[model samples]
Target chain A: MQKDASLTTPAAIRKLVRAGDYSGHTSGFAPGFVQANLVILPKQYAFDFLQFSQANPKSCPIIATSHSPGVTDMPTVGEDIDIRSDLPRYRIFKNGQMVEEVTDISDVWRDDLVTFLIGCSFSFEEALIAAGLEIRNITEHKNVPMYVTNMPCQSAGMFHANMVVSMRPMKPADAIRAIQVCSRFPSVHGAPVHFGDPAAIGIKNINKPEFGDAVTIKNGEVPVFWACGVTPQIAIANAAPDFCITHSPGHMLITDIPNSRMAAL
Target chain B: MQKDASLTTPAAIRKLVRAGDYSGHTSGFAPGFVQANLVILPKQYAFDFLQFSQANPKSCPIIATSHSPGVTDMPTVGEDIDIRSDLPRYRIFKNGQMVEEVTDISDVWRDDLVTFLIGCSFSFEEALIAAGLEIRNITEHKNVPMYVTNMPCQSAGMFHANMVVSMRPMKPADAIRAIQVCSRFPSVHGAPVHFGDPAAIGIKNINKPEFGDAVTIKNGEVPVFWACGVTPQIAIANAAPDFCITHSPGHMLITDIPNSRMAAL
Candidate 1:
């Protein structure tokens, strides 16, 4: 919680991360701001990966991307969100295997790398909570349950995988309200992809999730599932890109853009 | 289908209805125009009813209201929509008892009357259908099944009733898409209030709807329920005002406003 001005502002948080003082997840650090999933790859695979994101928007909503290879500063999303070090934690991968976890990517930075900032669920979750809908995972203090689904993603070149989804249990009425609230933020997964029967999308057990801790599903509540940011990661790994870098799970690139700025309405 | 120009233009449809040539339900006429639920009340009850609409916006989304008592021509919604004769069918009620249904209300029109144009579901249904989601009621060629819910509406002075909801059957994915599409048209019912178990909303039997014919719920489909336009009528009936009128069910006032005009985005 090194939140000083850093806790309140995106640029300040990046400053702290750049100074090697913090290496933690960015959730709850800056209210009302956009937090993005970071993906970096050599320019060779950038074109195909961009196509994959554009083709499957709900799972991989692109907020901003580097205008050209080797550009480290994303001035559009934030004043100076240096891709090499702004994120507190980075995962380096080689040929699809995660090779190292580091506080900053400055040492691993390459001129041929292109960075992508994909919309994260934090934006929509903020929206739903603001609308007075109780988010079960937030209430239970756990990562929203994420599951791999039978629903396949449209592949682009070598990248291919099934769509992944994050689930939140809500009463039917609250779920409806959540849908309306989330729809406004199209960049942040928009509305849910599915709800009701989990097995319909190939989830076998409700209590256990593949990627995150499970929350209590109260009686009479149905699980609502949204396209998860993890879908692209899985697709990238399956592609076995020779070199890649990404923010560690929950440790996102905080941006100056407000969540409301992404709303369609 | 006296369409031609009249079939496509809302004002032209009003002209036909005014001349006593068309007196049927307005469905499928003026394809992309907005159709409104009509409610007329004496000046004395206007304040209370307006309060009711304000308090319960989801159920009673008031698109426009009479600027002043005795002004029948609503220039805002259309060029020349005469509340007295524009709608194909008008129901005359005295102390909450329906007296007669007629093509023209010119004879019964009162100088003290104020008209309210409420958003109808037709707008969102068009949007959903355009998005390729099946509306079960339309496929079944039946009125949307409506249920009386135990969910109580906020009451205004001399007006009170439990919320009434119209049900639509859709597969969960389609229902989620419907919610997003409908959310853009807040002037209509907006998003569904509930989906999944009917018992949650106090509807004892899903098959036995209180109003409108029941549409079949397929194996994977869930019943998505929206706050209904019928709500105002129930409130009006509870109020039991001495003089009142409403458009006969499905016989709406076709407005010059295009359906696309209602999208909040």
Candidate 2:
């Protein structure tokens, strides 16, 4: 799908996604808006999931949850949003494996479902870019390389998984600036968890990532890693709930909240 | 030579230093209070010196300046503060070279002198310590290591010199937390300029520092550097005006203002 010039605001973009037409990566789609990672589970698992997010805020920062399961008017994040079908794409899972992919889930929407919007890296990436720091993945025109780390999440109920991290290579100066800029948005994976010597965090090879494409790390540049939104997905898969759904990688749910609105400073 | 119990408050400490009895390192003295770096110059160099501080704020963050030349009291930072004798020790310089070291400058106090209080690292180090981060220098019982860097300060009139930085080693996670904690005290150097590599910032050897004793860098820890208050002193020494007086290393002006008062958050 090419760029949809008509989809200017997040509402317009969501309207298109709801109408079953636009299903592509949401990057560069909504310029100043907050893009979130989506997770849908049965209401029975809601409390445990919320606990999981609170315990590991860096990996799974819960921005907004459904007011009550089944009703989806998130006035705080959007003007007229529907959790069931407002995202560009979603992956459906059954017993720990991805079963199918879809643009909208209105047909499968259920009253027992609870929607969670986890803060995405797009928000912090936008901040870093605005600060004049170059993002390695964006410059290389490749997916951000992600790795599974040795760090374990504080398990909640049946959910248990190791952390997944996204890598960005930068000079020490740029990395320092990035940490300051990213610190403001705690909801968006505030600050890097680790940098330099990938082996320190159990990343055996810098070039071969478990997910996304590897970007260039120059001589002076070190690989800075952030707690990834994908960690919850890994957790969900490990738990292997009977049914699960999450936004397809890079296809986020763009909300009305401006990126600047997320800054704690 | 030892922690003085009688010097309980900034006023009491000032009185002792004023009476020529307590002349020693101000660290851990008057706990929870602000200990400031003192810089006094001839009136001819005040405006340009202030401009230099304003330009290179990270390297030379000026918290307060004398209301006007010839004034001895700085009520903004402390009440009944006698600038001429409050600090434990003063270094008198003639044409950029140290001419004498004295406990008090009242004998040579001039009407054409202006004083400035630069924020000290002790403020943020206290905060980091409170947060359970180990300051390597304090842990090793040595002065924080300092080095002259190739990064140049923005010159103002006759004031000009390369920036000097202080180094502390920490694991990557601890370094991230330190960044967040130090960010709240922008008056005290704000965030670090660089990390990971020493040569990138023009430091030839980590162990062989220009000022202060070296601390241990553990197997997994990396040295984190901050914009040292020494930069302004270096700039002043390079400028080589007719006369100047500054606090001796570790001899600071104990202010009534609490360390909590300096937090910008």
Using TM-score, give the best candidate's number. 2
Model 2: clashing residue pairs? none
Residue-by-residue lDDT tens digits, candidate 1, B21-125? 888998888889999999999999999999999999889999999899998889899996788989999999999999999999888777899999999999999
Tell me candidate 2's fraction of native contacts, as a decimal between 0 and 1: 0.84
- Over the stretch B183-211, how does candidate 2's per-residue lDDT look in tens digits? 88999898888887999989999999999
| True lDDT of residue A27, candidate 1 | 83
TM-score of each: 0.92, 0.97
For model 2, how does the per-residue alpha-carbon lDDT over A54-140 read when each residue is reduced to its tens digit?
999999999999888888678889988988888888999988899999888888888988999999999999999999999989998
Worst 10 residues of 1 chain A by lDDT: A1-10
Global CA lDDT computed for model 1 = 0.91
Task: List candidate 1 stretches off by more than 4 Å.
Answer: A5-7, A79-82, B1-8, B79-81
| Chain A TM-score relative to the true structure, per candidate | 0.98, 0.97
